[model samples]
Target: MDLEKPARPPAAAPAGEGCLVVAVRVPVRIVVLVLVVPVRMAWDALVVAGRSLNDTLLRPLGRALPWVGRAVFVWPFAGLWRYVLVPSGKGLAWLGKVLVVLPAVALHRHVLTPLGRGAVWVYARVLTPVGHVLAAIGAGVRTGALWLGRCLVVVPSAWLYRWVLAPVGRAAVRCAKGLARLVETVVAGIGTGLYRGARILLVLPALAVWHRVLAPVGRVLAVVAREVGDALGHAWRVAGYVSIAVGRRLGTLLRRVFVEPARWVHRSVLTPVGHVVRDAVLRPLGDAARAVGRATRQALAAARASVRRARADLRRTLLGGQTGAERKPQLTHRREPNGPRTRTLDGSTTALTKD
Candidate 1:
């Protein structure tokens, strides 16, 4: 809404009144300058000077001091191996020496020492007496067992050996002698005849059969096996030759059917098709895609420029500048002659302008 003022003639204030107002404001500003302005200016000047000094001189000096010392002073003496590495090595050695002993000492004082003492005390106070008593008891048990074994087992076994086992053993010996004599008599009467009968009845027949029957059969079977093996060897050789011929034919068939035909089709058919595709399809499609990408990029750039301009205008407005009075550039379009036409997303052909 326009708050339109009615047009009227300007009313002039008296010159004296304007002069009086100026006069009053001038003294007040002078008083403020005397009181507040000097202090604030002093503080701001000091802060700026200090910060500038720190940034330019102090910071550079601080950085240069370390670099200069390391390069000039420290590095010059760093090559003295004894002065540099020896002290550090000694310090580390001392540290390791001290630290290693702490654990060992702690173990001996807190654990091993107590454990050894406890073991000695236990052995002296408890196990020593117990071992003596155990030894006495063991000795008594051994002596008693020895006495019992001699009285019960040894004496009784001796009596059994004298009274029962001795007589039985003597009778067994006599019986064994009589049995031997009888065996000798039987051997003399029948052993020779039996041996001759076995030779005639079983051994000689088996030997004759082995020599006449089994041996001849084994030789015949061996001859038949040898002939069969020879025939199988001949058949295997024939099959191997036939297989070699068949494999050669198969190799030719496979080459003609698969490898050669595949190569021919790739050369005669696929190559031409690939050229046609590259020319008719891929080239035009790539051109179209590049054109579309350029158009999209141009549109996006324009939108971004517009957004940036809007943001700048908004910032100016926020910073107390007049917002509505900023002159915005207008886009204009002109038609081109014999130029490639660009289509909008909506399929409209619009004129384009450079500016």
Candidate 2:
């Protein structure tokens, strides 16, 4: 048992590829690469930009769009369906059930069902017996007709066919067979002549044209088509490589010129400046704002307490020595037990004691 994989055979060279194809392929590939590289780079750039735009802007917008639509369009329609349309539909359904469905049901049950039952009863009791009587009469008539026809027509036809018509028909058939043989021979000769003439005039010439003229032209066209297809495939592959190389070089140039310097500025300059601003300016501002808020809240609380004391003193001087807050709340409703206690052995409510 050999476990090793078999070596594949080398491919044969294409018989159709000539000097013309070889000469065309190099220049075509070079020209195609030049033309395609710019387009490919633009395509790649557009693809990258589209992905970035989708990530940065369009995806968030798409996610937000459902909520916006719910707020603007969906919620209002839902409210209308829930509050207005649903009730209207239910009311209409109830009205239709009352006006249409109920009447139809009553008519079917009271009027149509009884009428259908009566029609079925009449068909079964009266019409079925009458149909049976007519069928019996028709069968008797048919039997009499068949007997009379056998006596008057069928016996005579049998005798005529056996004695007179059969002998004449046999003589006629013999003559017809002889005439048919003669006609067949003449037709076969004519058909043979026509076939030969048609072959000489039409078929042979058409065959020659197909073999001599069309076959060579078709083969040349096939060769040219194959060469053109191969050339195109080669050119497309070369163009892809050229496009990738150009894109990498352009990307490197752009990164070196713009991205590195911007990164350096952000890391080395802006970050330190931001830190300094946070410590020096924003921190002190936040602390001062918090202290001001605390002082305002304390002053407002003190003022509120002073107002309450003044109100309490005014109430004592004016209205009999008590403010409303000092008065006790009165009970309006009483709390009660859930039910009476269960009977014990000593109680008369027990079954034995009652008996």
Q: Output the number of the lDDT-best candidate.
A: 2
Q: What is the TM-score of each candidate against the true structure?
A: 0.42, 0.44
- Across residues 255-331, which tens digit of lDDT does each residue of candidate 1 receive? 99999999999999999999999999999999999999999999999999898889878888688665544757665
The TM-score measured for candidate 1 stands at 0.42
Q: Candidate 1 has which clashing residue pairs, if any?
A: none
Model 2: ten consecutive residues of lowest lDDT: 330-339
Q: How do the residues 23-58 of candidate 2 rate in per-residue lDDT, one tens digit apiece?
A: 898799999999999999999999999999999999
lDDT of each: 0.90, 0.93
Point out where model 1 deviates above 4 Å.
1-172, 187-191, 307-355
What's the distance in Å from true for residue 238, model 2? 0.6
